[model samples]
Target: MARAKNVLWIMCDQLRYDYLGCTGHPSLKTPNIDAMAKRGVLFTNAYVQSPICGPSRMSFYTGRYMRSHGSHWNGWPLRVGEPTLGDHLKKIGVRNVLVGKTHMAPDLEGMKMLGIPPESIIGVHVAECGFEPYERDDGLHPTGRPRPKYDEYLRQQGFEATNPWEHWANSGAADDGSLQNGWLLVHADKAARVPDEHSETPYMTRRAMDFISEAETDGTPWCLHLSYIKPHWPYIAPEPYASMYSTADMIPVIRSERERQNPHPVFGAYMDMRYSRNMARDDAREKVIPTYMGLISQIDDQMGVLMKFLEARGLLETTMIVFTSDHGDYLGDHWMGEKDLFHEQSAKIPLIIIDPSREADATRGTRSDALVEAIDLAPTFVDYFGGKVPAHILEGRSLLPLLRGPTPPDWRKVAFSEYDYAMQDVRLKLNQPIERCRLFMVFDGRWKYIHASGFRPMLYDLETDPQEFVDRGDDPDCAGIIARLQAELFDWALHPNDHITTPREKIAAYADNQLQVKGGILIGIWDEAELAAIRDKIDQRAKM
Candidate 1:
């Protein structure tokens, strides 16, 4: 039989495209990813469907949008029977294994919906990546650390790596689980010194390679989705990568007060100065840029370990290696820190695929202007396995054509990127900045239209102002462009190809669970008459 084609999907958490050398970051020392770029097709303009972690990951895992999966926010479960990349691989003759932080449905209730019994989780080959198992004593963010007593539990397992005592000896809890509290992510002075065994990258790379070796011997083609949560926060990476960038050299220009301050009321909320006061205080900005670069460099180094394993095992010639991220970080762009919305900084991600057989010398090292979306990835892999495409389940196209041809077949076509139904801020009620209810955008090489829920649409000519400082919606010259884009947006809105694919009752129940856990009703109240009309509309949709 022909060698079983294996798929090694390597994903980093919250990584931006420009943070790597391959993506033209002058200061980035991502030698591993850069080397892989030489052999694979690097997509220049790949975007995530949702800007936040959970929703973005949902689209990637399901190959469907948040509207389709019913997992719009964190804690919302991916409904039963919704196919995943793992599920698709299993559908074929492949054995699928998820070996790392599958933020999607890693807990109990979610596994129930997916028909994976608790008993089945035991004895599985799983993730061994990251600085350490974020000792989740608090049970907030998955990366949250365990109390010292928990380290005792590891010692019980004969743990000899970390001192464990000194790791969090004097670390104070600024904010248990809040990205908004940027200071909560302390300057990890110790992170740069963390050793190899404690590092998640080396651990994950070893498991992935071992898994590859075991599969090869077993005569089974495997698909392993390995997620590494690094360069996300806790900016700790071992030495070399830690020293890669200097604060003086790494600080990209921050937005000046004179720049058109609030671009889109929604977009502005993300990059707002008041929002990131903590991160910008007293040289914090300078320290942050180099640290972020350092974290990325470390991820690249660990990525090197996996690449070396592939070459040593002679699997490089047959396996498909994919590198991408759940979302991007603001990283001081527009005076922002984390990924909370649909900005160029957070929405754009590094998407590279190395299909061992296809040769693209003319395309290699060169970038493709082809507009690709996160939703396209699952279907692309599905098609790679010679599986039939389910038209109803997929809203995006595979990048195979773009890899074959550097420029998009149609230059006029644009890509779409969106944010959440309710952009949350604990400081403000979820509906407070109802500036834009829905964020939708269509942008080619030049212009972008930010469609809001209730406010005026935002138009920007990226060619004239790449920084997106000036809003062109009011400009008379761009009136023609605005009208054309509005028409396109209206058409798209009327018939969203993938809108809450699950039943209304199911979707409503999930949203209800969200309200309950959050202890706040974020949905706007339209009077009974309006709600009744909406229900009737939904009933009408059901009939259709």
Candidate 2:
């Protein structure tokens, strides 16, 4: 089998694994992705470093954890010097093209619509990620009605939720409305269709497809990325898919109190917060599941149409199509409705690779339970494109060997995922609970160790308690377990967050973007220098 010169990386925002039929949801009809999974390989236990959008994507491109990449929240772009798959691909003769949103906003405040700031780092992130011919969607709502005016929606509801931006997204406006959703989902029928002026996904998808078609004959293998924003937020799918799945057929609540043992305080506290909102504990899962599954079903429909175009021109076999998501959505899990926090529902993502050039043994529908992280995706793409792994010493290993079958004895037996949701994510959003944002999780294949930055730790035996409803990180009886996992967690904690640095330290590089760490600092465009001076002042305080 020869190498695959063409690659298609298809990404959806906030898509959970269980919500897809290819990943084992019988009720969800994802024939294209499922069929792609059948012919390719499926990683059943894939997780993202962060449970949010920008950070998850940053890890994918940089092969570093959120804290390491300094992208702990929604809006931060990679420091200019950060390495990216696109950067690596270009070295091996693959021209990189980007389509759709890469939520690498410059600061957390940029996520006002999603508990973020007023500004974002989209341009900087795209530049740092190293992909050329960049196109992005407007970070506002998708409706010609001007995204239903989130601020206005909040005002209408008499919501005094502080941040007007955050309050709107959290309003019923976020959900895909149907009778089952009650008031939880905003009924916005006029929200459908991506307008030619502001529609990024549809326009970018067509542009990406055109690139794929043109690249096929150029004799230069290319990596074309088509990122869709649907199935993410404001969960309004078009007709048909919008009404595809009914709540009756949706999978009901899956909490097993009988399976509960010890749970983390922070995790418990997080759920309670959601319940404090409008999220209910009773059958809330059933109501949300259909809408979530329907969103996925809609994404699948678009993908199916794309595949048809590729196959129509006889480009399917020669190209390797990789299907995945930036992160998973909670979809009302644990009385929660969004990403963040350290539960499986929020951290898990789907990774499927279909390499048409692989031998039959590697091409079948076999599933591997191996733990893979979103960061590893870069190396896998680089390896497939016949490119060199830049000398960055990335945190994630390539999946090429795993795809070859039988893991090597010396290979790291466990997969690792980390989240710093409490610290940076909190500070980014002003007035966030300063003390509560201290949770950290380290998951091996079997056991998971969670160490809250400033609180008691937690441990869970994922084998016996797969749901992770129980915590043993501080259990006196499990001292040995805590001691062992802590060693790794501690090393990871103190490790330098940067992976790909620049030749000119002053000119930090991102994928297609760049940052300046010249003064040994990188700050937001506004107040960056002022913040630096403030940090210097704070550093003197530490000395005092």
Candidate 3:
């Protein structure tokens, strides 16, 4: 089978693993994504290295754990000189470009310390999460620094407001001539004021389609990271999508009294936060959840539009379509509103890879329960292009083998995730230092363990308590299991690609050659014929 000539990586923000029909969402319609899964391999238990947007995406883009990249939270910079998917793909002659948000912060300090001028090409690439930005839009314009590109586009369309992102794109109009900002609970059911075509999701999809159309003119293998910022916050959709889902269609919240009562101190802190506590109310959830589902449905419809465009252009056959999200949204699940916990609702995400190569035919329409990580994407893309996996630099194993229908015998058994909430006000109230405000989670399909810095560890026997209502960390009988999971976590924490002074090839080049020195034992002989050949050369040299 031939290698995939191009890659189309589509990432959605804050989408949960079970939200799609393919992943067993009861009512949410995601036919396009579900069909993509049927045409490829879907990983049922994929997890992110971190449950936050920026850090999780950094892991996926760099093929390294969050610790390796050091971009621990939103607005944090991925330190300069770190290798990303774009960097790895470029080595094999693939042009990786971005069409949308990366949620990246440039390492200004690292650039200054390294003497890299911000105006330089390398510096520009570093600032854009290592991608050559075709059309970059992080889509959080109103909250963060202003993005003039999107704002200008909206103005040209005659939205004509001080902050179009807030007034038009994210908010809706009430009958009484009042404005609904979408963030407030009172406006949760309101439709977005912007037209469907001008909304962030469809606009990005159109731009992605344009990128594909342009890339086709040049026959070079290109990977376009088409990221969409939707179904995230300001969860209002345009027109029909806004009215598609009612509160009746919203899935029941996955929480229990046992979970809210006597929770672990760290978990309890999250539960007490306004984000969690506000959503705990049934009224707040009913008002917001329908809009959330509406945004997801809108995304799914746009996906259909994009896929049809790809098929029409004949690019679908040659392009590998990879779909995933940065992390899951709690939406009142486990008594939490946003991600940053070890529960499946927050850490687990949907991963579908549709390799157009005939080699993947056998695995098509099948699902694998193998523990997959978001970081595996970079190595998978590299391997898809027939490039060698740089194991020393990229800490993830390639999924090409699994995509071709056979799970490698050495696939990972444990999945890992992490969170650091020290910067939050809740941490200050908890009196935990920034250094001690972290948590690490390890799950082996059945049993899950969470280790919080400066707090008691928590355990959930998933086989018995899948909803995670029980904390068995202090159970005397579970001591052995706790120790085993702790050891696994310790082993994972030990190996990070921090030191990059030497490549793995240079270190391995000396491994066996060191023993072949002048006074070393003769070890190259395979059989008598080879030994005799060597002896003949030695004898001739002795005579000389």
Task: Pick the lDDT winner.
Answer: 3
Over 1-544, each residue of candidate 2 has an lDDT whose tens digit, in order, gives 3434677889988888787877777688988788888877898888888777777888887777766777766655565445667667766777777776666543323333344223234444345366654455424342321222333444555644444333333233334552222224434222333222223344456767767667656667777777777577655444455466776666655454532334454555555554323343445544455656666776676677788898897777778788998877766655566777666777888888877665535536878777788878777778776666653546777777777676556765555565655544233443436545655667777788777765678777989988766666666898988888889777777864453453333343233233345688574646768766766765776577
Model 2 ranges with Cα > 4 A deviation: 1-4, 106-128, 138-204, 256-263, 274-276, 281-287, 422-438, 494-544
Model 1's TM-score against the true structure: 0.77
Give the local distance difference test score of model 2.
Answer: 0.63
Model 3's alpha-carbon lDDT is 0.86
Residue-by-residue lDDT tens digits, candidate 3, 43-126: 988999999988899999999998788888989999888898988888899998998889989999999999988779988888
Report the C-alpha lDDT of model 1 over 105-150, residue by residue, as the tens digit. 4445545555566445321111111112222221124344333443
TM per prediction: 0.77, 0.74, 0.93
Provide backbone clash counts, one per model: 7, 37, 0
Worst 10 residues of 3 by lDDT: 509-518
Best by TM-score: 3
RMSD of each: 11.8, 12.8, 4.3
Q: List the residue pairs that clash in candidate 3.
A: none
Candidates in descending TM-score order: 3, 1, 2
Worst 10 residues of 2 by lDDT: 189-198
